[model samples]
Target: MKHELKGLYAALLVPFDKDGQIIESGLREIVRNAIDVQQLDGLYVNGSSGENFLMNTEQKKTVFRIAKEEAQNEIKLIAQVGSLDLNEAIALGQYATELGYDALSAVTPFYYPFTFEEIRDYYFKIIEATQNDMIIYSIPGLTGVNITIDQFKTLFENEHIIGVKYTAPDFFLLERLRHAFPDKLIFSGFDEMLVQAAISGVDGAIGSTYNINGVRAQAIFKEARLGNVEKAYALQKESNDIIESVLNMGLYPTLKAALGEKGINTGLPKAPFHPFDESLRPQLKSLIQKYNL
Candidate 1:
């Protein structure tokens, strides 16, 4: 099935106060910046980057609702409603479908060392219940459940199982999957590897760093595909510099801090995730000015 839900998407970040309460205005500001300023193609709400795993069911739904409302069908939206709780996944999937998300993505069931069949069944259950297009979230590094090409073959047998958010660095498998399933959509999940993934034939990308560096991400993806290798790599190098620093200071908090610097009201991260270090403000500010983020 040819779908229109393909392009550069900010893995949608959420802001919260000290009590881990969602900051509604801050959240709206972030969404607005993503659409208006960053010019992202879409928002991937309630995904790992949004700290989805840390929030309860109600919080997740609130995010989905808020993003949909703020976006108002201006850009395509994909909801990452995956949870270890199967029932929650179904309910969230149904909810996002009702909210008119362009598509639904769910991480592979993790932390239990589930067999391939069980994981397959988990996806099947969500798709069957929600009756929406499903994109498999395959980040084996985090999930520890790797689906081989043949297994993907089996999952893709279902028309509702439309594609995958391929997060691993294994280009051989990516190439093979591209060759094997020309019809299925494949979105690269890593921001740092945007250039390579674009050249590897991914339909688009869903990334965390895209929240801040989406313009460059869009450039890298387009330049690489247009065979402007040198220009694409230049942007990738710049983006990687930002990614590396963000990883060093911290991913979520640091990104929020970067946005907060722009007066976007990106409050502190949820509890237990440390606030962005005040001492690093100088370095963060330097990065912001240097990159024009």
Candidate 2:
């Protein structure tokens, strides 16, 4: 059976010790909060917000294992197994499938300036590697490659291919994709842009900010689906305000700090990315309380 990849999914944050080691307990707590407390519809594991780029293969696999074991099929789990290495991508995809992940997503192969054909081949290879359905992760800002409408059509034609995590700000293209393939699932990648993406008919959202603000995000989506634009707009504005503050405070670090303050022990982000200082802890605490996160 095909997997149903829809609704508000948190692009989970990976916590690490001060020594830059994965804090398994902290990570499990965070995932539990996202699933049981926040009541998110699902999780998007190992995305940019999860610090996937900084992690090695073993670390990535550990995250997948822990998330799956802890999640225990309570909610949907979409494992992001994408990488620049095609072989690694396939390996991770298969591994995640075996771990009972609901679906697999891969960000467009990045950094090497691959041709369109090469990108297509990358997806083809991953889909061929496992029987699990795939979601194309299109974050042009990070990947430097945006799958065009034509490319999307080509991909959706594949039986195992399901949908995309559409991250770009271009609503025109998003509208076009929706018009062209009404049945395909399209997840909004930008938390700030969720209102517009939902307005444009995105099936759901996978956002970093949802970890803390999931209730509000869910309200926005529910209101929009109910045709209450005015209410949805108000909630979206609140979400954007929180996200703006997070961006200013350093996205990953601030998020971890906020989680830590909430007693999740989200640890520090894996390295090259610094943890928020003791001074900033008070500020993050204030922000969290202010937002009622």
Candidate 3:
């Protein structure tokens, strides 16, 4: 709560070796790229972009440790400690808090058909255990747990439950949350919709694409805040062209491939997630060249 968590954040991408192990050196490089090159405000480590679900608990901790040690508080570092296992989430939350993460975000408890009360209790347990500010990572499109405004009201009652990384496409709910909980921090999650969320008054944003397109994202955020919607829209259009291509080629792999082109060892996406097609390299290069990414 004290960090005044606002501004553009790369959903911090982690690099891996062929054996699907954490490429620590590569990760340190990526963090440096985000802070130094991209000029992003923070790194959302171990979020969806980091392939959190695929990693073991130790791997997640390693990411938090490396990002903190590397960043050295130069920029904000948010550790996504959410997991299906409650104990794991708690342990990870504690670890991140100790390491000085700016904030802790947890995806809504998923997989099981958990009731609202169960979900609420899950958040409470983590906050109580860690004693750190919490951001609810609500991406119902993938998690299938849609939280209602009334439910949000219940969750926001706790002072430690600081805000949410709202990844859903519901602008209506986003607006309502903004109007209702004006004090709570709201981070827009979907990269392609950054302009709309910025216009709707989100504190800032977090996304995977920001790793490559962060400078533009900062422009869009600043322009929109300054009431330059036309400029923001134009930039958004150009950004969407890039985002569409990345999604079509493959999300994580294509992003890594883009970063790789810049001499950053971003490696490939983790197992179960396929790599970007070699055939697409020409096109991906065109994007990198076009965007100067």
Maximum-lDDT candidate? 3
Model 1 misplaced stretches (Cα beyond 4 Å): none
**Which is superior by TM-score, 1 or 2?**
1
Task: Name the runs in model 2 displaced over 4 angstroms.
Answer: 1-3
Per-candidate Cα lDDT values, in order, are 0.92, 0.89, 0.93
Model 2 agreement with the true structure over 1-293: per-residue lDDT tens digits:
34366799999999998787789998899899898777899999999999999999999999999999999979899999999888888999999999999889999988998998898888989989887898999989987897788988899999778899999999999999999998888899999988888888889999998888898999999888888999999999998989988898899988888877778989888879877767766777778888899
Global lDDT of model 1:
0.92
lDDT string, candidate 3, 1-293, tens digits: 53468888999999988778999988998999999999999999999999999999999999999999999979988889999999999999999999999889999998889999999999999999999999999999998999999999999999999899999999999999999999999999999999999999999999999999999999999999999999999999999999999999999999899889889888778898887799999999988888888
Candidate 3: worst-modelled 10 consecutive residues by lDDT: 1-10
In every candidate, how many clashes are there?
0, 0, 0
Query: Of the candidates numbered 2 and 3, which has the greater lDDT value?
Result: 3
* Residue ranges of candidate 3 with Cα displaced over 4 Å: none
Model 1 poorest 10 in a row by lDDT: 1-10
